[model samples]
Target: MKYFIKVVLAESYKQHRNYFNNKMIYVSLFLWPLLSFLASYYSYKAFDLEESAISYINSGNILVFLLIGYMAMSFFRSVVQSAWRFSSERQSGTLEYIYLSPASRLAVLMGNALSSVFESSVVMLVFGILMIFYNRESLHANVVGLVVVMPIYVIMALLWGVFINACFLYSRDTDFLFTILEEPMEIFSGVKVPVMIFPGWAKLLSCIFPLTYALEALRQVTLNNSDLGTIKITVLISILIIVVLLAATLITIHIVEKHVRKTGNIILF
Candidate 1:
């Protein structure tokens, strides 16, 4: 337990030094999301959407809806970034040192994921505060609900990061897969639009992505004024997804380890 905590802190510090060392990252972290919010807000305004239509599609207050969507996307971004960083380590030959070390692979990955999540959360926090101030009149959410839902969302993202990192361990390049998955995930996971508006087939596809449930539960609790009981099923489903993803991550790590040992090829070409 002590060692795990140490690993997490060390990795977190490394992340701060490596990525947050730049003043530009601090600026871009807040600026990019703010730009995204503006783009979506103005684009929706171009449609001159009716109050009823906006309410139906976005659960009212398009700004708040887009704000939450962008915040959620930050979590997913953390997962992808962590996975990509892991792949970079492999490319740089540092992944072999990781494999040779006595430290727990899962612990190290969790540390990496946590650091990414921490950084992403900083971005989310800044945007969240800005949203609250700008849309103070329109925005409404139960503070208790946010307190309850956010940790689960973070855990889900971390599990996803671990799984993706494990999968990347077996691959030389992840660009093709990342390209195929990223945009579709943003769309199908309801980052910008309500999942309820998706066609039946698309809805079914959305179910395969945990972000769908995370967003649904978030919107329910925050925008729709849903009680914990109302979102119990969604929360349970997210937990189940976490469990399944953890199992998959463990299995992948075991397989990768065995394959590396057998083939003596830590970096796949």
Candidate 2:
């Protein structure tokens, strides 16, 4: 266990160091969240709503809403991006090198996930601070809910990574899948508005989205004053998702490992 933790931590730090060292990338990392904020502010402005109402809505609760949406996007982005990292390494002939290591595949993926977690943390912190300053609202963040729900959120995030990694292992062309998940997740997951506001059918469909559990969990803690019942239900669903996804990922990897051993088709030509 100690060895595995060291390996994951080392790998995570290496990835984080490389990524953070890229100045241009860092600039864009900060800018993307800002762009989301600007778009949310102006898009609402385009409706010609009263300036005070718009300010109240956008800078206050609405701004938090937009930030949370982007936060979910950040998680999705991390999962997809981490999956593609494997494909990219394969193309560059490094995938096998990593796989040849003795570490568990899940450990390696967890390390990559840690990299994403770091990036997302930075994004959330920077933007969260900005939002707090702009809105001037006392955060009064829920410590216990944040602690409990975060693990579930991390597990749920892995589903996207595992699915994409499986797709890359088989087809090697998953851009369409990525695009498909992007919008519907943002739309149905209460990124822009409350999911309760959705029509019956839409709400039903959205309930299946992984982000639904995450948003609900976060909303209960942040908006509803740490509603334990809501958090418990969301945590349960998120745990189920993580288990299912992790199982699928392992199965897929085993199949691919077998195929590669038999046919030596490790690289797609």
Candidate 3:
């Protein structure tokens, strides 16, 4: 276990070092999150809702939902980034060379996941701080609960990342799936609008998407300033979903990897 940690950390550090050397990546890493936040904020402003309404929203209550919803979206971004990046490397035959090394596949995946995760977290933190300042509201929530729930969300997201990477390993064309999933998630997961606004059927469908639970969980912390006790139901549901989805995702990955090898199409691209 200790050896594995050292390898993963070394790989992750190497990846980070390479990323830092790329100027475009560094600029995009800083700009994308701020741009996303500004885009959402401006879109809302364009609605011309009264200032009073907007100010009330800046309150910790409403801002928390937005904060968490974006965070959940960040997971989706991480997975897509990982999948595509991996696929690109595979297409260039670089991934094949990497796999020949003695390093663990999980360790390599962690390195990839870390690259994307860093970008996503940077975006989230930037947007969150901006929201706090814009609202001029001091935020408070269950610090302990936030800490507990975050790792679960990351685990869930990582499962999806694994599943997607597995798909790319064989099909090498899951970009369509990624795009389709991302668009709907952005629209229906209550990122820019409240889920309450969705009709019953729409809300039900959206709930089927994992991002809904993530957004709701974060909203509990950001908007309601609620503790773990207050939001136990949502947390419980999220925990259950994460467990089931992760298990299924991992199984699918194993099956897919084996299938690709058997078919000799692991490099399908």
TM-score of 1: 0.90
Candidate 2 structure, TM-score to reference: 0.80
lDDT of 1 by residue, 1-269 (tens): 89878876776687667667776775676687678768877887766546444353442477777778878877777677777766777767878888898777777777777777768557676767686578766555666777788888888988887777777777675556567566777889987777887899999989988888888888777777777887899999998999999999999888888888898777654
Query: Could you say which candidate leads in TM-score?
Result: 1
Compute the lDDT for candidate 2. Answer: 0.67
Report lDDT (CA) for all predictions. Answer: 0.76, 0.67, 0.66
lDDT of 2 by residue, 1-269 (tens): 98788877876786677566775675676577567656875676555434433222333455665676677666766666666665666676666767677876656666766676557446655766577567646343576887888777766876656666666665456556667766777788876666776889989979767888787777566644565664686778788877877887888767777776677656663
Best lDDT goes to which candidate? Answer: 1
Candidate 3: minimum summed lDDT over ten consecutive residues — where? 51-60
Candidate 2 lDDT for residue 63: 60
lDDT of 3: 0.66
Native-structure RMSD, model 2: 3.9
Question: For residue 102, what is the lDDT in candidate 1?
Answer: 75
**Ten contiguous residues minimizing lDDT sum, candidate 2:** 50-59
